[model samples]
Target: MLSQFKTPLLLLSSLALCACSAVTQLSSTQSDATITIKEGKHSGNPRSETLKTTSFGNYEFKVEQPQGKVLYGVLPLKFNGGYLAADILFFAPAAFFNLREVYPYYEFDTEKGVVRYKNKPQDSWLEYAPLAAESERAKAYFNAKP
Candidate 1:
């Protein structure tokens, strides 16, 4: 009886793994900001993407405002509690994979001209406080004479 159920269970797990990617929506208050993903595996438009849940890496993104103010940051990803629970209940091996849930909001400090984002999945959103030298570098990058 146990052997009879093994094949079906394997098939189910395979299907679940194949459909593990999550659809994430990226949004910012600056409607004119151009979003560019510098890294990570994702598909779809800049405003939305299907992100791989099992991938472990930083998704570096740059938000360039219409006025040429550019801010760089990483998109946040957290572990999905529901998926974790399911993995634990069904296949213990799947729990070893890094299954992440993407947060839909991207916060920006328009005044400071820095993009704010979480450094880790469980940490609070980071605030950008650039040093004088860093600020100068940013200014130089944006205002360089062509």
Candidate 2:
């Protein structure tokens, strides 16, 4: 009976370990798409660039910095919350975004240069960037037009 009990215990422990590993992989696997701008042509370096990646891909604008040399910027589209949260954070720069009324995007500090946008971050996996946000642009454009 004791040997039988030991075998069962070992099997149970193995299952528990597998479950824990699966959960760890699930959380760790979650990653967002990065949007970066290529200046001249270097390749790789420190300071990772970023950009919000939502279900609805709507990033397609060149942000013109008000001051400074005008380096690129990116927003970490993937975070605790995507799209909605990312948008609220990404396009926080309503100044330049104001002009791109159709998209209504943002720009936050990141490791690499800046990432520009012209639409709100969406939460749809199918939707992609290079797309236009003409509808949203008409609405929010005037609210904070640049």
Cα-based lDDT for every prediction: 0.58, 0.29
Q: List where candidate 1 sits over 4 angstroms from the true fold.
A: 1-19, 38-46, 107-146
Structural RMSD, model 2: 16.9
Off by over 4 Å in 2: 23-146
Clash count, candidate 1: 0
- What does candidate 2's lDDT look like per residue over 26-91, in tens digits? 000112222223221111221223332234333222322234322222222322232234336544
Candidate 2 at residue 14, lDDT?
64
lDDT digits (tens) for residues 1-146 of candidate 1: 79999998898877676547655555455776666553334322236666566545555555567797766555556667777777777776776564675564446554465555553446686555444565455445434534
RMSD to truth, every model: 7.3, 16.9
**Worst 10-residue stretch by lDDT in candidate 2?**
21-30
